[model samples]
Target: MKRESSLKRATTETDVSLALNIDGSGIARISTGVGFFDHMLTLFTKHGKFDLNIEASGDKADNHHAIEDIGILLGKAFYEALGDKAGINRYAFQFTPMDEALCRTCVDISGRGYLVFDVPLTREFIGDFETELLEEFFVAFTANSKMTLHIASLYGTNNHHIVEGIFKSLGRTLKTACAIEAGNTEIPSTKGIIE
Candidate 1:
């Protein structure tokens, strides 16, 4: 069975919907009023080889609600799609470089959601998307997806490059972590369950 999920959320601040496929050919169709965020999502989907589609609308221009909500919905989709996490590798890491920037991302689908973000951004905003919200996005994602994620930027001078590298590295790491192991049809934990 193909691992897939579709989810939606509506609030006074935003309304967002998402669809995800863990085993796919890197196809993405995303729109949220935030252009920079859309670009980042596209890169993540492409690198992860995950099929994702998102549509969001609301008070996205003046605040952080839209981006955060998208992260929440996406994370929920992932959790729903992965269901039981049997046979998954469950742990992976990757390092990606963009121009003069480099970032490392590590993930464990341990059913314990936590995030360790240690990145430095050279600017406050990258095309209207606040740089600090990058952490917020990942925080929401990690908590909802029930995974432990650690992202660190070893070095970076350009804010865009650093952020791009982070997303790309995260995508690659998740791709591996979610992969199925050959002849290992069991949950990755010693307890015989992931959650």
Candidate 2:
């Protein structure tokens, strides 16, 4: 069974379309107009071993509209794909090291949207992507995916390395959490339901 979702959200503001697959080989076709953002997202897909495609257009004058809209679209897709959250691992954690940086990430696919992000960048921006946008990405992802996420950069000197560690860590964690467990059709939570 292949689960997928497509969403379009528009005001006078922006238009975004996002589609995702929970069980897929790593493949990505992304266009967000923000080059660095696209790169990070591509890494996200590749590392997470997910197939994802996104096309978004918004007021370039304000990156906020485009960024937030993508979040909304992705959230909707995750919620749709997990429908009832049966037979999933439901929880995962990872600690990844990228050269000098180390990041730890944990997630619970419990139909709850909560995020704990802790990474203080030595610089305000990396390329055109603001350092703070990392937070926005997780906030949006958790909210849309209806999952609890915790990300922390335990040690890193370079801002780029730090952020890269976080994304890679998250990707690996999600990859594990979403894996299908054979012969298990119940929510992994002890409560019988993830909600």
Candidate 3:
């Protein structure tokens, strides 16, 4: 069976449509009107080996709302795709490096939403993408996905590389955590249920 989900959200601030395939060949089709964000999402998809498609539009004032809403939808799609979470690894972590920057991302699909983001970005923006929105995206995603996510920038100077490493680590981590384990047919939890 294909592990996939899709969703669409419309609010006063933005409108976002997203589709995700947890088991895929790393194909991405993204258009958020934020070039740098598009690049980040593309790389993320490629690293995770997940197919993702996103189309979003936000207010003319800024693109923050669109990205955050995308996070919300993306998280929902993942939750829906995982279903009962049977046989999934359920926990994973990754350390990714881009140039001189390194980031660590960890995740646990315990159906309890939490986030611990500690990336220090000095730059206010990466191209047209605001650095502040990076945390917002993860925050929104973690909350909506009902997962525990911890991201830490071990070291980084270049803002672009720092952000890239974070997203890449996140992608790789989730990819591992969502994988189905061989010969394991039950949920990977002692509680008998994730929630």
Leading candidate by lDDT: 3
lDDT by residue (1-195, candidate 2, tens digit) is 776676778767888888898777889999998888888788888999888899988885757778877877887788888777788788999999989999999999988899998887878778888777778877887898889999999998988888877877877898888887898888777777775
Residue 95 lDDT, candidate 3, scale 0-100: 90
Q: What Cα-based lDDT does every candidate model obtain? A: 0.91, 0.83, 0.93
Q: 2 or 3: which has the higher TM-score? A: 3
lDDT tens digits by residue: candidate 1, 1-195: 789999999999999999999998899999988899999999999999999999998683564898889989888888989999989999999989999999999999999999999997778889978888899999999999999999999998988999999989988999999999888789888898887
Runs in model 3 deviating more than 4 A are none
Pitting candidate 1 against candidate 3, the one with the higher TM-score is 3
Model 3, 1-195: lDDT tens digits are: 678998999998898999999999999999999999999999899999999999999999887889899999999999988989999999999999899998999999999999999989999989999999998999999999999999999998899999989888888999999999988889988899986
Candidate 2 clashes: the total is 1
Model 3 lDDT vs. the true structure?
0.93
Best by TM-score: 3
**TM-score for each candidate, following the candidate numbering:** 0.97, 0.95, 0.98
